[model samples]
Target: MTMINPAGIPHGYNTPIPSEILTADRVETRIGTLEFTDGFPSDDTAAKVFDHLDFLRAVEVFLQCVPAASMEGLRAGLLDIGCDAAHKMVIADRLLDSNPLFLTGNTDTVYALAMLDLHRDGPTVVQIPPGCGPGTVNDAWFRFVTDMGAPGPDRGAGGNYLIVPPEYEGEIPDGYFVSHSPSYTNLLALRGFVVEGKTDVAKAMFEDGVKIYPLSAADARPEMEFSSFSGKEFNTIHANDRTFYNEMADVIRREPIDVIDPETRGLLASIGIRKDRAFAPDEQMCGTLADAAAVGNATARSIVFQTRDKRAYFYEDRKWKTGFVGGDYRWLDGDGRDGRNMDARTMFFYQATLNTPAMALEMVGVGSQYALTERDASGAFLQGSHSYRLTLPSGVPAKDFWSVIVYDPQTRSELQTGQPLPSRSSENNRTELVYNDDGSIDLTFSPEPPSEHRGNWIQTVPSKSWYAILRLYGPLKPWFDKTWKPHDIERI
Candidate 1:
């Protein structure tokens, strides 16, 4: 709606036009030169900016859809391992080791994993017995759907859980904990704690008690099948290549159109990743998306490995940090006073899986807490070739127990060393750890075994980079009040 004065005014308008509103003849940007004539962009300028816009949008999509791709990768990996149905699942009967390329999976607990397809099964039912540890169900986007076991409504006295899809209008039967998920594909990951350094009880409990079946088949449910994935070379880590976009496309095609918001859907569409159509981009666009993936992967790596956010640090003086920054499971910045923290979201999903309020909320002695450190004292990254020592002071504030697991920075998985499990838990390594007269425990990290602390030594590969995560199960008040803190790792 242009209202041009038929008779030109003194300065082409009734008032002088501000320079800010007018376009110059030429403008330079990081993308390239943008040329315009009388406020109209040249064809080359329009094409350049449009291409750059698509590239930027593609990068955002990669960052935003990382969770989706990760979940899809889990599903695909499970399917490859013969866990193709809801009744079939994989369990770490012995415990997870370095063989599996999982995202920061701890070696302390027995894990059970399953992929549920509500679209295929209609309504799914999960039944577990008493003594089942913490478990969670995440949507295709890795959003928290519900918790089971300790943090669940049953409070470790496990019962039946009915998970239905978003479009489900079926009757809610009594005596079941119902959860509605917006996506068809959901990941059900369960963990069972090791008691007295043994995984036999937890493994047997899952094998004997856990049952999953479609609710419609309640009268004649299929038999539950469990496969042991301990020491297996399984891959659940998402692709960092251009195939990451394909993983997102698969999830989009599998789930309903309304699974994601319109803004996210439009962003994917901008990169030709719409569910209604094929995700086949032209040759030039393919190369652009590949480059975008490289950039996105590098950004995610930086966010996880070298975060600039101070809130991630657990202590002002130490390198120990928390994975759930801002203490919000939703990844909201300042509790949503600012919108979603995009980098925070990437930081978590890039290196770890699972999203539950139990990991964020202040449950003190009830929930678990984690402190990760990639660097040692003197603000130096932990080198595999160098020797270091870490000391946990007296009165370690864990009600149940604590564990420290070493992980490779590149894979974000358990470090591949001579030891089967690249970790030492209080329960698992009680007989091995040497305690000082003052009741403090000192651990050694080096390529060679230490003479004085041979039992406390964890093998590290030379020329590699690694990190460590100190997990406190049932952390007590001292942990929250900052009265207790793990000492920084010092070079030895």
Candidate 2:
């Protein structure tokens, strides 16, 4: 007796069947069985298959660029709240609340966020605060337009800067650091350090210092309005469905066609989005696009948290990770020979917004740095009910400031608990943080505040999983040299 396949085929692998009996009518089929391998029945069927594949390919490209798309959506949302180009949104109260307004937003500093549409407002002027850490100017695509503070032209002292819109051939003004923007819409974000956790001092700086308006209306410009968004719930993440494609279409229609690469433009065209044309997809095409968007979203999420490449991990023995897994901001491999790394792009966008070459470069004493982790030292995903501890060595590597912020793994936004801001930082208010003899400080994560180290603890919720980001505002040489490394979180 011999074991036989359920399909009534011969038991041995070497057995052969008669070709005549292989006809479709005589063969039993299952879910994955190929009913017809000869080819598609008609040209229409072949064309439809090709179109769906192309649609999916375009979706892959779209998902890879979600960071830029998400930044655009945030700008739009800000505009919706207040249409004035000169207005700014700042955290009015203690710290930034657990809102989906921005990804990995820091509560350690008072943020003055300005959204501008130069196409409508013409040339705009931005006033930067001196000594403010890292302020950034990004365009519609979230491409880095300029940096403010120590590394910027302002050099940590306040200065007036002018930004001319695309296609603006106006007179180049004198005595001002000028930048020509490549996109019509722009984002101006200023991070002001607070004194001893007194946000009022930082908030005042924004109110008295920051200004933005059309150059022509400088004298009569409306006073810069500051809106406090503390404790508010809003969305800043881009949609992962058909709405995402619509947002990209809107950006293409509003900005110059050259803002994105030609290859990207072609991909958009394949999906029925072209500059200066109505982006109307038929019902069948829309269905295919929706399915593509779902897959695209899943792809980016997988890259963000489950990346298997060894290069993604920070150390051989720790779970600390970097969003730019390749160590280069531009996603270039160490050899610099391989083409763009799509997984790196996906990781960045899924976790944060904005893109700039400065982030990719290694600055000796200045510039920003980031570390992300979703797991504990035991190589297990973080659980809300579990308490954990992390230790920051005596000589923390941040020349400016360091913050450990907890974020919801799903939204990539601040993790909401009883506390508004689920973070602890080496800023003004945390001055009393007890440090060890060697200067190492311990931080705790638990639903209930720690019995002793209250200042060094971040609150966690009991029902939600979370991740964290360690931001070094002005990363020092030790960080770059790998001489100073923060210990991973361990279960208490």
Candidate 3:
């Protein structure tokens, strides 16, 4: 049976599709039918479209995974995988939307909290002790506010306050503890201290029925306050990864913070810590330290932290760092002296945006694609033979950084040859790159560049199928707008 669309284009696949399968438009037609509907309203129709596009995209992706001549079985295998990928995307997207932190910046903090809940046994209390310094208070506030409930993609319940010196219990001291409801969203309780002195504080905490005494606010610091809370593990998943930092900032900027207490709320406002925006600290050192620790622990064979591209891929031989506290200064030391460190700090505010539960779901998409192409197949490329070329179209849109990376298709990790991987960006300037008259650029890949094109050429050994990833940092308008498309690799 031959099926043709209104435009007379053939739609049927060269390989026979199951009879139960309907065309994307639901119009019954024979083989080769190609109908273009305005849009798909049903999941079935959308699935068909996604499946078709995914198959086409997989063809190009798979070509980079294995040798072209031996791709027949591999191609079939990928087709099955692509179908699954389509379904996964749909399910994942749905999961993301339903998550309380989906479009919010609280994702990573929430995820880390969830991980802690999963790994650690027993009930967790997010304590805001009295007398914590500004930084410690801020850190505790962010963590508690972000993660305090069921610990899933959805915003869990907020913590309940065990406010020291209950409102009815006479004049509160200058130092008091505040607790927020763990069950409600945006719940907070402020404990005040009317009387001064450690003994007085301790008595008030005990007699007034408080679990912990607030540290002296004047002497409070992140390290000092965090130290007091022993035994409970602290997971810093958002601090180190640049991608998470950027995303968190975006989420914070969007969600409005509702502070029921006027004095505390005003205090937050005076410091420029707006409820709808990110923390006031110009540099989010603690979060950065946390991120570095996570990356360090996760680091495997190689860890490449790309600030410009806002992506870090780590491969480690052993279990990497997970929960992080203190030692933040060590990570900063490696960050150059240039104002770059400050810039990284500004980037930290955005971590909440990228580390959400929905973001975890998105990882499903990236991971599946990564795993599929990295598997070793009979048709996989050998050590060296073919040359690959990727051409960046004009007007590539990226703000902070952009780069293309080659991954060992079989390993799915960064290809670690003696030489640094091939990359072109503002960060790694190829002075010898030959720019076209129009100002566009071309990158050539081969084991050996033609003598004249050596400057713009990257080496690729024969027979090894490799995958390419185009990374875009900062605002993604240009890439999202389709004004720019990732370079396509072609064999010479």
The candidate that wins on lDDT is 1
- The per-residue C-alpha lDDT of model 1 at residue 135 equals 94
Using TM-score as the yardstick, the better of models 1 and 2 is 1
Report the number of the highest-TM-score candidate.
1
User: Cα lDDT of all candidates, in order?
Assistant: 0.89, 0.77, 0.31
Worst 10 residues of 2 by lDDT: 25-34
> Candidate 1: RMSD over Cα atoms?
2.8
lDDT of 3 by residue, 15-96 (tens): 5545455435535433233444532345665555544443333222212111111112211222232312111100111111
258-344 in candidate 2: lDDT tens per residue? Answer: 788898888788888889899998997788788888888888878888887778877787888887767665677765798777788
RMSD of each: 2.8, 6.4, 23.6
Stretches of model 2 off by over 4 angstroms after superposition:
1-48, 87-93, 334-336, 428-432
Shift in Å, residue 12, candidate 2: 36
